[model samples]
Target: MKKVLSIGLVRGVLGQILGTAAGIGLMTAIRTAMGLGWKAEPAAVLGAFFGVFGFLIAVGVVTDWWKWAKGEETSEAEDFQETPGTRRYFGVSLDHKVIGIQYIVTSLILMAFGGSFALAFRTELASSGMQFLTFQLFNTLVGMHGMVLIISILLGIAGMANYLVPLLVGARDMAFPRLNAFGFWIAVPGSLVLLSAILVGGFDTGWTGYPPLSLRAPLGMQMFFVGVFFNGWSSILGALNLIATILRKRAKGMGMFRMPIFVWGVLATSIIAMTATQLIGLSFQLVLFERLLGMPFFDANNGGNPILFQHLFWFYSHPAVYVFVLPGLGIISELLPVFVRKPLFGYKWVAMSSLGIALTGFLVWGHHMFTAGIEDYLRVPFMYSTLLVAVPTGVKFFSWIATLWQGRIRFPVPMLFVLGGIVVFLLGGLTGPPNGTVSTDLHLHDTYFVVGHFHDTMFGGYIFPLFAAIYYWYPKVTGRKLNETLGKLHFYLMTPAFLAMTLGQMRIGMLGMRRRIADYDPAQGFGPTQMVITIAGFLVTLSVLFLFINLIRSARRGEAAVGNIWESRSPEWAILPSPAPAHNYERDFQVVGDPYDYGLADSQFVELLPQPSSDD
Candidate 1:
């Protein structure tokens, strides 16, 4: 009983309840004094803010900072220490590895939640008439589905970054260990607040949360804004920590070029997170202020421009697509050479292409707004820039194919997922130009076609690759591999189902089915296609459920993996033991050879050095 109470997760939840009550009371008291009635929206906002602070305090992330404020000195080594049981994972542990595991668990939970909502809505759309969910409920589900899944993706990327980057760079831990923990811990409260939207009157504005519509949305809309606003801190601070760690903490002789290809993906992603995430935060806050303070930031009736909101929103949102995919794409590149037993065909070009994609991602946000009535000349520029992304992206796809040509290919579960990602993402890529081109976009905009295109990009670029990464690295994280048969079942079932769902969506969309509507017009001859899409959605859900079952069962009873299971050149596999120790490397190491020189005989990627003598 006492041990459970002492756990960080329990304490944080209790703290959140107390803090929320305190905030609601304070707001109610202030309103009483001002002769105004109590309002749920304002109270919820202040409560969410205080609740996050309370959770952090309870979790002890702020403990060291509190001591430092009083001129106290603490041992820096404390940050590297961790408790030896499952309890360590439930609280604020300074170990980067613990934090990384925390990220993976939380991300998977959110994915299931968001995906369930997707299935519910897809059921309602099966026959076009309202089945179980209300019209407003349907809208809320669709919007939350998008935003929550996005949060999952961000957390997923962070998990991969925290676990892999330090090991790759030969550092003991991140540049700032406490900050890394803090960045992760904050997302917990933020996600809770976001989910709280469902309890209140749900909001109807999509995740975009554009104003005018957003201004008039239910009070739950504020929670969405506040939740994302709080989560943004996680993204921003995490990026800062990663950038600093990569730049300052490389092993001896490990120059930027010599770092793992995935590190370049992390570098590019962190750049976008650092600079561009703020725009989304700022845009959401503008809407919050408009709602609470009676401001008119997007109210055209009060002299505000709705179009301006789109500009601010997409500035981060579009580049955020790159934020989502670059790491996943990097995972694809990093793993292909291993499975194919060949060198990455153009290592430097692939690395440079990540930077190119990051830089180019910023300029292409305007393409999303092409149908939204931007200037005529601006559309042409945006069109050209949007197309330019294909060049660097093409570099990646071509490089991957070249690396695989006539090599000794092994199709493990991870490799199967990697190959699947290429084909699906290519579908996404091929479908993109129609939307990027002004003429074709005029027909596809706001339709199911657009919905299909986005899903392809998301799954291929992030979700599929995420599965590959998890499968590839599961042995290193847990000294055991997932069930191979179940994994192959997952991949095979999901790929075909997803293809059907997205393709059906695109096809119906072209025949005049709109996006985000609860009921479709039966008169449009869309009944058969809608039913198929719904069935496909459920199949995808089933496949994911199998994956979860495999993970749980495998973690405890699967075959033991004591050493490098993948037979790869990366330091984590080639040198470290399976389920790497608390202190990742007992002795310092130096980079000695190429990261992906798979075909070369008698070549080593890193050379471990002896620990320093204590007597000296």
Candidate 2:
């Protein structure tokens, strides 16, 4: 019992419970003193707020800072040695690798919850007459599914950046390890609060939570707002940490351009995450305040412009897509050269393209408002800006194709996912212009077609690349390879299932199926298509199950992979052993050549400095 209580996660959760109770009691006391009755919504919001801080304090993520407040000194020595094994993962630690794993594991757990919500709603949509689910429940599931998966994607991005960025740059750890740990730990309680919405009365506004609708949503709305508010802190802080690490922590001779291509993607992503995440947080907070304090920020009935909400939300949310994709695209770029055994074609162009996408992403948010009654003049410019994103995106595609041209290519599990990501992302890209253009978007707005396109982008840009990264880096993290047979099974089953589902959705949507509806009329002749999508959804779920099994079984029984498994030039794989060390790089190494000069004879990317003689 003591051992379990000693775990930070357990203690944090218990702390959240106590804090929530205290908040409710305090709110009740205040209400009684004011001669008012208890209200669930305001009390719940306060409790959720208190719960987040409680989790942080109990987890000990803020312990060092707390000690610093009193002028106490905290040891900066590496502590992973003391905790030793799995226990370190459950507790607070300053190691970036452990924090990265924590973020990823939490992301997968959230994915399971989000995916489960999706499967439930997809099942309900199979035959279309709200078979088992209530109308409110269906609406709640759809919204929760979108928001939850989005949060999961953000965490997944953080996970990859945290784990790979330092190793790629030959840094000992993140520039601010404590800040990194704090960023990750805060998201735990935030996610709990987000999920707690379902336990309360679930909100009906979709994930966008547009105003007028959001103003009238139930208590759960505040939970969603508060949850996302806290999670945004993680994104903003993590981005700041990544930027500092990349700027200051590279080994000798590793100049800006010479760093691995993945670092460029992270840098571009960090730029967006740091500057733009505040808008969404502000937008959500506005709605929360409107609900709690009757602020007229988005209350249309009170002379506040509801359209203002769209601007604030999409300003962050649209660029937020690049925030999710750039790193995954980087993963694709990073791994492509290893599998193809060639230099990345147009390396500088590909790197700059990431920045280009980030810059262009900010200008394109107005495209989402084409049919939302925005002014006429803003439409064409936003349209052009939206299409401009295709240019940088096209650069990546060109680089990938050229790199694959006449190269020795291998089809590892990771390579399979990379290829799958390319195809799916291409589908997403091709479908995007229609939505970006005003005339076409007027026809397709709020339809299953848009849903299909969005899913394609997410699956292609983030999900597939994330899986590829995990498969490629698993040996480095665990000193064991995932089962190839099962991985192939996961890829084959999921890819086709996803394609079928997406295509079926687009087809039905073109045939007049709207999104977020609990039912469709039988006369619309959409039952067969919807059923196919639902079945495909289940198949995708099964494939993920296969991956989970592979991850677990292979961790213990898989083949030993202690050496360079991929034969790449990256420091993490070529120079370091499997399951990278806590401090990374026993000796300082300097960048000596191009990062992806795979086919060049006698080329080296980095050179390790020799150790000094003890006699000296």
Candidate 3:
């Protein structure tokens, strides 16, 4: 373990160095291409620097990723082989736990940065733009905000979870931990490339990276394309690792049905990631190469339909939503049983429901393009599929309610967040069917209504649940409990802010407001709606202060957490207080009951039927 750590540190450092150099090379090429009189623009120069630096750091970690991947051999099965200490972890380690932390930390950084950009927008929109930022800068901020948030979700949930899932489920490590790390590290270059666009040329196509407009933009579009493609690759590889691990790795008695809801959620997500995430990778890469190399894959003037790219883009990108949101659903599912004080009701149903959503999620990408000018018949099939997703989603909702029905519910901060998640997710889910139909989507398409609906679900599904997971499990990762009072305050302020902010958008959408325009037409008179959203946005910003305060304070002086804080049922809670050890359980743990059989006798817990031994 010590040896692996040293090697990991070395590799990590090296990857960062290489990545930085590569990014600078790309920047140099772009500058030359634009014929900028031997001097690069300041923003482009800065973007290239950070993008290259960030990519190098991400790629560095990929070097040690092999120890994490699966085959006949595993790091653990090798049983304490001497690993050389180097700077590899500074580059990459195959350790799922380390990679997971990398993803999580990266996501948080993006969140803070993105949120700041959003706050900038809110302030600007509050009284109309006061010339605080140029039109180009404002557009760049909006586009970058979208790109960063998407990266946060993909990296934080998918990258981090890929590393952690094997440990959480009580396997030695992920079935393909090395590949898992590789996927995650690949995202670095992509992020840097996208960032380069902002620093170097500033594309306003938004994170969706729409073509034509993107094609017409400066070198920024190409950079956005490159970054998105790399990020997509990371997701695909991470998904494949999770699927293989869940399918093959398990302690003696854990069965498919016996797998934790978190695993089920990830399992479903993996399928989506493996199958659907790839198309976007291909499309984005092709788009970048085409734009740079004059291939013109989506240029209609060259006999290519731009909308065809939209279809291909949506083919992966839509399911990518499930990839993003489903893991969040898994996080909620993992927490509710503990907070609600009951075994998850309809475990099979809830688990299967995640899979159902992932599958159905793919068929509904057309809903995004309703305004992109596709056929009329295409709309209804897309509509039906979009609406059908709600059914599986509904079943999961019912299962949560069932789990909570008449239980000894604890309203701890984590619990409060989980409840909030359900409320918001349901609100978002309910809105889908209406918009799924051709008539309704036509009305709300690209409106703030769609924007509001997604935030409710996405934030509800991801953010609240993320905090819940953080509160519920951060102790396991970092041996400290965030201040309780501050946490509660955080929840209180955030929940209302999320509601007000999201719901306000719906109101504006209903009043016939569109999205992505920097200024609203005076005829629309968006002053009041904009004000409400802006205020709600500030409230949400205020709530973030509590978290920042609490985390910083707790890290400095918070009481060390107990081994079994919250009395969690999962293996994660089984670790000791403060700095979880390598090889968490010294001995193979013998399970005697259902994971959440808190009040019931361990004997009363139904034993899931065992699986055939790996040896068999």
Candidate 4:
């Protein structure tokens, strides 16, 4: 019992519960003193703050800093020397690899919740009228689905960045190890706060949570605001840590241009996350304050412009799309050459495209607001900027195809997923230009067509690539490879289903089907299409279930895969043994050649330290 209580996760949960009660009690006391009624929104908001703080404290994320502040001596060990067991994962281990796995587990949990929400709404949409779910509940499910999946995506990328960046860069740990742990641990309380919204009357403003409507949303709306607001801290700080690590912690001879392609992707993503995340947090807080304090930040009648909220929200939200996908795209770039047995085609251009995408991502947020009553003059420029993203994005596609030209390509599970990403993302890219044009967007905006395009982008840019990464790296993390048959099954089932679902959505969307509605008209002739989409949605879920089964069953039972499982040229695989050591690299390495010198004989990406002779 004591051992369990000592676990950071358990302690953090208990602390959050007590802190929540205390926050509510404090709010009640303050209201009583002021002769005002106790409010759920204000109390919940305070409770959220306290809950997160309490969790951080209980997890001991700041213990070393606190000790320093008290003028006490502290151990300088970078490795936490965590005991070898599952219990270490529950506690705050400063090891980057352990933190990475923690992020992956947390992401999967969130994905399960978010995907369940999606299935619920998808079932409701199968037939026009609502089935077993109230309109408000359905609305909440849809909104929750979006936000939860987004948080899951962020965590997924963070997991990839955290685990891969250090080893790839030849660093022992992150530049700020405690900060890395803190950034990850914070997501737990943040997700809990977000999920608590459903119990608090639910927010129906969609993930964007634009104001006016948001100002008048239920008490649960505050939970949603507080959830994403806190999650933003994770993103911002994680990005900061990654940028610092990559810039300062590279192996000897590793330069900015010589880093792995995925590292560049992370670099671009971190830049966006660090700079743009604050806007979303700021926007959500404004709405929270408006609701709790009766401030009119977006209340037009009270002299606040509602459109101002959109500007602030999308400024981060659109770039946030890049934050979610750049790493996946980087994964795609990183893995393509390995399997294709070719040097990454146009390496400099591919590296620069990530930054180009990040920069162009910022100027294109206004495209989402083209019909949101923004200035007429602004729409044209926004359209152009939105269209400009395709250029650098196109460079990536061409380069990938070129890299695969007549090469000895291997179709492993990871490669299958990489290929899947290309096809789906290509669909997403092709469909985007139509929306970039104002006339076409006027027809397609707020319709299932837009939803289809967005899903294509997400699946292609993140989900598929994420699966590829997990499969490719599972061996390194677990010292056992996932079942090839199960992985192939996962891909085949999911790919066809997702493609059909999204394509069906686009087809019906052009026929006038709107988005986010719980029910639709039977006369619209969309029943068959909706049924197909719903069925496909369930199939995708089943496919993911297969993946879960594969992961669990294969962890102990799968083929042992120690030592350069993929025979790749990346630093981590070339040097580290399976299940990578706590501190990655027992000795420092030097970058001696190109990151993806796949076909070059006698070429090495990094030079490992010399081992001492047994005679000595």
The best candidate by lDDT is: 2
Per-residue lDDT over 416-493 for candidate 4, one digit per residue giving the tens place of the 0 to 100 score: 999999999999999988888888998898899999999999999999999999999999999999999999999999
Q: In model 2, which residue pairs have backbone atoms overlapping below 3 Å? A: none
- Model 1: per-residue Cα lDDT over 1-616, one tens digit each: 7877788888898888888888988999999899998788888888888888888888878888998899998768444456568889998888888889899899999999899989889889999789999989999999999999999999999999999999888888888899999999999999999998877877898789977889989988988998898889999999999999999999998998898999999999999999999999999999899999988888888998889999999999999999999999999999999999999999999999999999999998888887888999999999999999999999999999999999999999999999999999999999999999998888888899999999999999999999999898998888998999999999999999999999999999898888888887689899999999999999999999889999999999988987777888887887789898877888888988989999899988898887788996
Off by over 4 Å in 2: 77-82, 613-616
Tens-digit lDDT track of model 3 for 249-299? 776566777677888888888898788877887777667666656787889
The window of 10 residues in a row where model 4 has the poorest summed lDDT is 75-84
TM-score for each predicted model, relative to the true structure? 0.98, 0.99, 0.87, 0.98
Model 3 residue runs over 4 Å out of place are 1-91, 575-578, 590-592, 604-616
Residue by residue across 99-179, what tens digits does model 2's lDDT show? 899999999999999999999999999895768999888889999999999999999999999999999999999999899
Q: What is residue 92's positional error in candidate 3, in angstroms?
A: 3.0
lDDT of each: 0.91, 0.93, 0.73, 0.92
Q: Is candidate 2 or candidate 3 better by TM-score?
A: 2
- Model 1 scores worst on lDDT over the 10 consecutive residues at 75-84
Which of 1 and 3 is the better model by lDDT?
A: 1
lDDT for 76 in candidate 2 is 81
**How much is 294 displaced in model 3, in angstroms?**
1.7
How far out, in Å, is residue 491 in model 4?
Answer: 0.5
Instruction: Name the lDDT value of residue 297 in candidate 1.
Output: 81
How high is the lDDT of residue 234 in model 1? 98
Error of 3 at 502 (Å): 1.1
TM-score, structure 3 vs. true: 0.87
